[model samples]
Target: MSSMKDAREATFIGRRTDGTRIRRPLSPHLQVYDMVQITSGLSVLNRATGIAWTVGSAFLVWWLMAAASGPQALAKAQWFFSSFLGILVLAGMTAVAWFHTFAGIRHLMWDAGHGFDLPSTWKTGKAVMVATGVATVLTWLIALISW
Candidate 1:
């Protein structure tokens, strides 16, 4: 049993014949790959925007809680939301939300076994970006007009 354990450990350690430890190959990372491709950028962006959306949803929850609290709390929340910095945050969250939505749709298409090829991937990525931009702008426009 001890010999078997030692043999297993020796194999795991992976020492070469020259008594040097064998080096494992590095996994692919950002430093190894070109990031110029739209598909890669969009894939990274989708994940990042998902995180952003979660953070943004916290603000929504706060607002809702304020509303439930009372008039004073709701007033304070409204004041903050109407401030310049608040407006900027809102705008960013809006864009993030729209981008996440479109990216999700793109992923669903891919899951359905469509758009696996490079050209299709590129086209879908570009379309998601364009749709996100247009939808975000239109949302803000309608919001401003109604305000």
Candidate 2:
């Protein structure tokens, strides 16, 4: 029994406080703990927008398949996408995707030793948001007239 206990403890080398292993803190970390309201809001917004875009890509795929399938299929898809609300949702998703993409590029730049300063980080973040809107609007308008 003592040998069994030693073997188990040896494999579990992490430090624990009160009978449980302590978890190391996450970085640029999760917002659920010891974080301010504004930071947490951004954190949640980032994640929610991510999920929305992921699911929303399915809509784009659906539209593409509809187009490939022929007029009747395309027509049905067009009817839905052409609706005001659906168009708005699509536009929103476009914006979110663009923002995520640009932000990812910004992170990549940081990993390569660029955009590490406060000014650059803020600039890149703001640019991600602004550029996404501009680019998404351009895309939505182009798509709207494409049938």
Candidate 3:
């Protein structure tokens, strides 16, 4: 009786009382992790930029289609793109694009078995960040000047 009581008191980890084993959340808390700032932060930023780039590309395609449709459609698209809010959004998209491009090149270097050492890895990561910022600024500056 004591043994049976103990068994009943203990947690039965797998399966329900009805006997079908299935996956379920066994705990209320989520699994958390700590990512390295220089490395993991860059990786996460890269992924985010990639997603942003895809969305930006879709918008660009829409703009192109608008142009192809007719002059009225093109004018509407241009008006939206020239608005203050639109310019801000375009700036953000440009920054994300630069960051993604630089990070991608860094990843390619990694694939080529370069910059694998801790020191080189950190250096390259920092370089990629600086390059992204510089590229973004230069791109915006050129756009403003040309316009």
Candidate 4:
């Protein structure tokens, strides 16, 4: 047990010229990594959008429940939804929904053995971003014009 402990310690630590022990990092750290690239950034965004969509769905459920409860509840819900902050939240949720949809489609393509290469990954990432933006903007434009 003592020999094993020494072996582990020797492998993990180094002695400097002045006899000081220096510990080596156990794994690669963020500081050594390059700036976020499109592939990785989009992957993270995809996960974030998924969570945001789930939360947005909860809000939808609340709105539905409010409508089912009473006229007062429905009115309050409608007023909140029509407020500026609520509109901002709705717009963000819209973007999240679109982004999650596009990212899911991208993942389905990957599962089908497409976009495995670096260039294709980047292309698909950019495509998902653009599609999400366009869809979100168009959705809001239509809603506003109809209103």
- lDDT tens per residue, model 1, 1-147: 124444435544456788987644546788978786797788888999999999889889999999999999999988998899999999999999999999999899989998899988888889998999999999999989998
lDDT per model vs. reference:
0.87, 0.73, 0.84, 0.86
RMSD of 2: 6.0
How does each model score on TM-score? 0.83, 0.64, 0.76, 0.78
The sequence of per-residue lDDT tens digits that candidate 3 reaches over residues 1-147 is 124355543464357789975444445422453465798889889998999899888779879999899999988988988899889879999999989989999999999999899999899999998998899999989999988
- Which lDDT tens digits does candidate 2 get at residues 1-147? 134445445554456667765434334555446554433444455677789888898998999999999999999998887798877877788788877776667667878999777777667767776877788888878886875
Per-prediction tally of clashes: 0, 0, 0, 0
Name the regions of candidate 3 deviating beyond 4 angstroms: 1-36
| Candidate 3 pairs with clashing backbones | none
Stretches of candidate 4 off by over 4 Å are: 1-26
Q: Identify the candidate with maximal TM-score.
A: 1
TM-score leaderboard ranking? 1, 4, 3, 2
Global CA lDDT of candidate 2, please?
0.73
lDDT of residue 76 for candidate 1: 95
Of 1 and 2, the candidate ahead on lDDT is 1
**lDDT (0-100) at residue 140 of candidate 1?**
94
Residue range with the least summed lDDT across 10 consecutive positions in model 1: 1-10
Which has the better TM-score: candidate 1, or candidate 4?
1
